[model samples]
Target chain A: MELSARNSLAGTVKAVKLGEVMAEVIIQVGENEIVAVITRSSAERLKLSVGDRVFAVVKATEVMVAK
Target chain B: MELSARNSLAGTVKAVKLGEVMAEVIIQVGENEIVAVITRSSAERLKLSVGDRVFAVVKATEVMVAK
Candidate 1:
């Protein structure tokens, strides 16, 4: 799918921690570990699991730069 | 300041586009250009401009994974 978001880091799902409303997904991208917190419904919709190949997508507007 | 956000890419400000209530910031991180949309007030408070050194920060919850 076409996405306007700029950052899309390819990675493997390392873990998935589901909470009441949110789910924390751990992705291993090279030597870096990226943690993503998403809605439990979306997580369930994606049926996310460990060992899955995915792209961690981030929107440019949601990004903040600190000096 | 300490941040809980996982992604913090160091970059230099390339451009800053100011609007009525929002501002778009373009940061050059290596070969990639990261765009950030922030409130005009925050942008003014930060005194953001071109050629400034900054770190693009993103929280985990704002990140999504696409398979």
Candidate 2:
């Protein structure tokens, strides 16, 4: 399906850190890896594991950078 | 508007670092901040400036965590 987010990077699951309420999902995209903190229930629903192929989609109204 | 993404974070623009091709945008979410790297054109289109409120959306097939 089409996404409104402008940034969509194809990546592989590198690691998963589950917490009580939040979970940290790490995706390796090329030389860099992006991390996403999500709900623990969401983690369980997806049943994410290592070596999973996933796309990281980020939608932001404004993307700011440090000068 | 409603989004399919499970993670939606409310943040404020802290800084913007523009580069030749890509730009890194930093948003302060409470005490924690999230960073997003997007194309320069996308950054310019949004005209992101400091203190702008934004919502960070992340969509992934699976949200994993380490056991």
Q: Which candidate wins on lDDT? A: 1
In model 2, which runs have C-alpha deviations exceeding 4 angstroms? B1-4, B7-67
By TM-score, the best candidate is 1
Angstrom error of the Cα, residue B43, model 1: value is: 2.6
Task: Give the CA lDDT, 0 to 100, for residue B36 in model 1.
Answer: 90
Q: What is the per-residue lDDT of model 1 for residues B1-67, given as tens digits with 9 covering 90 to 100?
A: 6877887777899999999999999998765677899899888999999999998888998999998
Candidate 1, position B31, lDDT: 59
For model 1, what fraction of the real interface contacts is kept? 0.85
Docking class of 2: incorrect
lDDT of 1 at B49: 90
Model 2 Cα shift for residue A8 (angstroms): 0.8
C-alpha TM-scores of all predictions: 0.73, 0.50
Say what the RMSD of model 2 is: 10.1
Candidate 1 regions with alpha-carbon error over 4 angstroms:
A29-32
Lowest lDDT sum, 10 consecutive residues, model 2 chain B, at: B55-64
Report the TM-score of chain B alone for all candidates: 0.90, 0.84
Q: Taking the tens digit of each residue's C-alpha lDDT, what string does model 2 give over B1-67?
A: 2333677778998998999978888999989989977777777878887898887656554446789
